[model samples]
Target chain A: MTATLLEPTADPVAAVRRARRGPRRRYLAVLGGLIVLATAAFAVNVLLGDYTYTVPDFFRILFGEQLPVATYLLMESKLPRAVLGILVGLCFGIGGAVFQTTLRNPLASPDVVGVTWGASTAAVVAVITFGLRGTAVSLAAIGGAVAVALLIRSVGGNVGSHRIVLVGVAMTAALASFIEYLLSRASIWDVQVALQWLAGSLHASDWPTVRAVALSAAILLPLLAVLSRSLRVTQLGDDLATGLGARRFAPDGMLLIAVLLVAVAVAASGPIAFVAFMAGPTARALNGGRPTLLGAGLVGVVLVLSADFVGHYLIGDITVPVGVLTGACGAPFMLWLLARGTSSRSSS
Target chain B: MSVSTSARLVAADVTIGYGERVVVEALDLAVPDGAVTVIVGANACGKSTLLRGMARLLRPQSGAVLLDGVAVHTRSTRDVARTLGLLPQQPITPEGITVVDLVGRGRHPHQGLLGRWTSADERAVTDALVVTGTLDLADRAVDELSGGQRQRVWIAMALAQDTDLLLLDEPTTYLDVAHQVEMLDLLADLNRNRGTTIVMVLHELNLAARYADHLVAMKAGRVVAEGAPHTVVTEEIVRDVFGLDNRVITDPVSGTPLVLPAGRHHRPSLLAGKSPTPEYEGAEYL
Candidate 1:
């Protein structure tokens, strides 16, 4: 017997629109609130310290009305560090999120992808082998990161997430060993300088480093925002994304740009640990399940600023590196993740 | 909503295969518009490959697949997607993705860079969900659904594309017999109600005969027979195509041709062996 089922009547567009709107608004509100809180924390961090200044005194120092020697410390020394911490944190956090989501793997951070390794290796080589000084090492680091990225992509075949990660890890390991070998043969003074740099300390911050990072951020962040939709489609696998009319090359280009941004940040401030790994997932978890680029950037800002504050002021006589603090926190989390992955695989 | 658009798909002398090993060669076929066409063949006979080529998933080595007199490969992918949708066999679903979100992705071609989650896209997604009887499960994660439910959700995703031409590769795969019948009936209903042109590769001959308005039987990458089920299916044709001893009988309900094979286990009784049985009558021997 032949019978026809009548087409059902419903408003699909309204349903999907409703679905997307609720999450978008909630994420935006949460991000906005976090931004305000981070700014307040930063203010508190700047004003209250060993040589304390009132809020009014801090504003006076900020505008160029000089007060005492303590005012200069608050304005020049601590303020710049706080600002730089926020900026670099933003770069690492958002950059890490884009990398992980695009790859569809949570472990695919810029550090895991050899960007950090490339930058650190180049910086170390420039200092010890080539006798380079000042910001020259930063430039060398960027070049190294780009070269490693291109090399990994070439060797990994198709630009899928898994292949990229595998190639990146292999290249990073090789380069890291070479860096260690160089360090072993260097003089005591050279080794001390290299070790301190590798520990990722923001010991000396000036207007120049800030300007360079700001310039790079200004160029890269807008590019990432424009290509965000394409990245979302790319996360749905290649065949489906291509069928949906997105060019396969667009996501790859965006990913390369993200790598460049993170590389620049690492070159400026050394490979600060865990900021890249924690920023994206922390933001996403706080803002619900949607991919949160801007939110991650804000969370990165909070992470770096708080770590810098604690590093400088928490221990009385001893100064801990911001990277050290991040490592101290992040290493345990990594071990937990590894344990989870192993257990899941075993059960399966 | 009542838009009557018909596009004929033609494959001319198509040769398709992976590298170094040719599967189908110099094949010519025309898929009729606004009709349910079933392609039937044994395993590895290139039925799925032909469907893939027609959907432009695979590039033809020697020929072209044309849509309404124009080469399909020449048009932009989005333009082609607007008119056609292809549901591949056993696609993987991303983790924690709800049925509504998955189905909403089918409207990607219709959405512009700035035009996401529009009212029209939502309408198409809802319509697809309702048509496939998946509206109630729209909020549930796709991975959590049953096999039949998951299959219907995928069909909903394709339907949400709102294309006039639909191609399916073994849509009833990994389902129970009841679910297979239910899926075929759903496809037939869609063809009748929306005038959506459909072509599918099916392994079940009886189901294809019952549902398809036209059947194209392929053997060794060539069309061995093409006609209505009653005209094409016969005892000799079955033996030639499938290499089996079988008898063709009319289905009691649909009056369609049905094949019943004579297996080694089915033995003739002593009384039946002694008598001259009629053409349609057979002795029950177990």
Candidate 2:
């Protein structure tokens, strides 16, 4: 009786392959489309800024042939800014997706979990009280994010993922108050400098800042790729992940890498609001609700570039900071997610 | 009874716990290879904890869980996973993951970082789905499947791991009576056809008694009795393990020991005047 039940009726290998093809194709198509979209957004950000330049002239400037007005504007500002945007976006996207996946909560992005607030508070303190500039401020931001991450872990102390998020929220609130207190004590000129920390701005982008972000991505992304196989296993929760032979510390290791990615990106640019928070969900939505780390990273690039463009050009008069635009856009989406009640669909 | 020296998995004086709570204390048992072993006890008797300890989900604090004569915890997890598979109770289903993709993930220990999906991997996954009768639901998202279908799909995932030993924790918890029997039958088939060593925690006593080749009854983190179901599942053991007033009788259909709880309100009119342990001819009726 059991033999008859165990017998295979036909070739199921073909059925399994056929089942996989549709989703595989859809994933590829979504991934390819994101790459194309990111490229276009980068182009639009660089070539169509306030002082617009033609494609040939932009390339000529890139190739080191100086056209008087185009040279300083393109080389000094637009190129570095756009490049920095893409790099920061990649870091935030990949890092945030890892956080959300591992913690099994969409709201567990680094920004929402106090990493951004930590960076901003430290950056503001460096600029205002310490009179720090450029690389020193960036260092402060990186240190701040890492410090907050450590604080969260120590304070939460094996309380599990949901408790960690609650602890982080409390930390973010505390750090945010510290920032406000510091701002209240600052002079007008200091306030202008500190505004970048309060709301993320790409206005400070230079070759050095671009290099810092690039170098971080260069070292970190490959490491992340090496560690990502366990990421897939870890998403099934700890017990099952262990059952499936995932390394004992793999989730913690991935989270640490994610924290560093967000830190470096925040160090290069001020904590760009919601890029980390929004990218993963967007990528998942685009890929027929499947998680795609690469797709999320590309989506992050597109999001930052487009947000930067809109913040820089689309708004009238004063240039709104990239973080401010993202905040405004992200708040609505967050509310939508809340209204949708994600308990039924959330994946760990 | 002597646990044979050839037993592949053994827990010798193992203690398991979480934080300050000691759940299973200094327990010893050897799992018979290629047989279905069902563990049944009241809630919090530490039966599940013992199962977790054996599966290496919880590390033993005092002694070691041995697999193939070596400390299981000392072995590389991937190597252990290739030999033993586990289906955790309430395993998470990633949002929008298809049945095939979820099942394919059971192949994790088999593949390296750069390993591509080979025909062998495909065969394993297909065989799993086919054996579990989930091939028709291969393309459907896991969240969309019914409770029974989802349970089968999870079993398929474990089956896809292609391990010789499988451990399940309460695999039939949420299923109706029919699905529970269906699940047990499927596991029995795996044991018979694939010669897989099966160990599971079950809440239903009569079902466990009917299906298990070996039955273990635990009370307060200690194994009170273990042997062939008929020998181990007497009315005295049931009262001792579960603290329930019950009668043990032969199942009319399966010729296995069947437990009939003697609740206050359910006494039959015909049996009201009879001796409590009245003998029956060949079998007992419900």
Candidate 3:
């Protein structure tokens, strides 16, 4: 009976649907795998810290039976950092995917396009120069991101991806020098804080940071989801999008949402280096080269959590920042991608 | 391809441009209902700009484009999208999107935020795939298809829009000769069977003459000729539009006008009792 139903002549529509379902199912399954991997990584992140909690002890902390030392570590450092890692990962991943899709270039993520550094430069300078901390720094960073985006748009003149990337790279260089100059001029104590913040460390993360990011996510994620449909239409290029009845500035809202997410993530953590740059590409690979926001975000969660875990436990006594590890991993991959891109362009 | 009954898209005194430079100026043209209207011109003669204006891709710098006697620019774009479909010159295919899903995106105007992906959308996509003969390629990646197949897939996407009017801009840019003919034939079939009011910018004069019921000619952002294919595809009009001395002949197969450019070198070969293929003693490139 099932075989009869499966026959093409009996239901050609069903046959077409069934044939189409295979790749989509594979994409979903890859996304599911990334989710599972991220959840497992998140668990490992909470379980293995300075005072290592066994699986059973971890459950006890989760279930509200809090022993003194274990509970203190769990509540103060471990839980907040793990949660913040996942949150930051989601933001960077989704943000990167949005930028890449909007600009139609793999290298157009927030980090590569200088939006992440825009936030970082503002936050770092705010801490060093203005003596601002916490929410004020975050707000400044958000403003900086918007300002940088506007500046890039103004300078780049709404050109192709390659030209915009060149402008972004120049912007990033200018801002990086500004940051370095700020670090050089700061007093020794201010310099340490600025350096940590510039490296995009989760070391300063506490319950408040996690809560703040979570609250922002609660408001922003839904908004991004709502706007993502228009983003999808905009991905088919301006002419086609306009033809499809999308408003002329439809992608503007989505880009702003993505920048806001990046700002919030960068505020909670530091710039968190290549998590934004790497997430979209990794997710596309896993999803069979389809640039999905969810998949990219999931990939980012895995990358950040796993990088944090590896940095803390696997690398021994010296505690490296998540941003450092991501930078180390991302540099070679970015170079390889650039090389492959040039070869492909030449061939085409 | 819904039957176009009352859907009339026309540009009245419309001018279009990128920024300061005007591409099309004061173009007063009416797309005849339920027929294939092909706009032909030399490169950068504003055929594309005219199509863009008619499709509402470009807001006219002056005057207005009318859809069913309503100003197209003033109407809600989502509402207009339901009645008219456009396939641009070079559309982007998002990486790794399957043929079916890509075509299914055409149902965008029909969807609400929460009520997206309905059974109606499924039926529209399926019918589009069937009509374009892309059902077998439904599971295939759009980026991986051949040039001709990709063109069909794009047409299928436009068909899934289920609009009474469809506009296309240079739909046969990179296609080879046979595929170009096949593409034209498929569009002709859609025009004949569905009564879709099709308007397109085409570079090929012979193909345009053969397929277009209504042929419009443009030169330097202005219309030089507008009427039936025979009236529009004459030698004088060709010279006027393209600035080329050309001989226009009746197509052996379709009885439509075929343009043969009378260049300095080719004229001697035409006069001599010899094959037009230039003789070369050297070996062909391997």
Q: What does candidate 2's lDDT look like per residue over A34-65, in tens digits?
A: 99999999999988967887888887888999
lDDT score of residue A172 within candidate 1: 79
Whole-model lDDT per candidate: 0.78, 0.87, 0.84
lDDT measured at residue A169 in model 1 versus the true structure, 0 to 100: 85
lDDT of 1 at A118: 81
Candidate 1 ranges with C-alpha deviation above 4 Å: A1-22, A29-37, A48-53, A287-289, A335-348, B1-7, B218-248, B259-286
Taking every candidate in turn, the Cα RMSD to the unseen true structure, in Å, is: 5.5, 4.5, 4.6
Pairs in steric clash, model 3: A200-A270
Best by TM-score: 2
Q: Please list all clashing residue pairs in model 2, or write none if there are none.
A: A235-A348
DockQ (0 to 1) for model 1: 0.24
Quote the lDDT for B251 in model 2.
98
Model 2 stretches with alpha carbons more than 4 Å out? A1-10, A158-160, A342-348, B1-5, B268-286
Q: Per-residue lDDT tens digits of candidate 1, residues B163-253? A: 8889898999999999999899889888988988889999998898898877888887878887677766888877777887778899998
Best by lDDT: 2
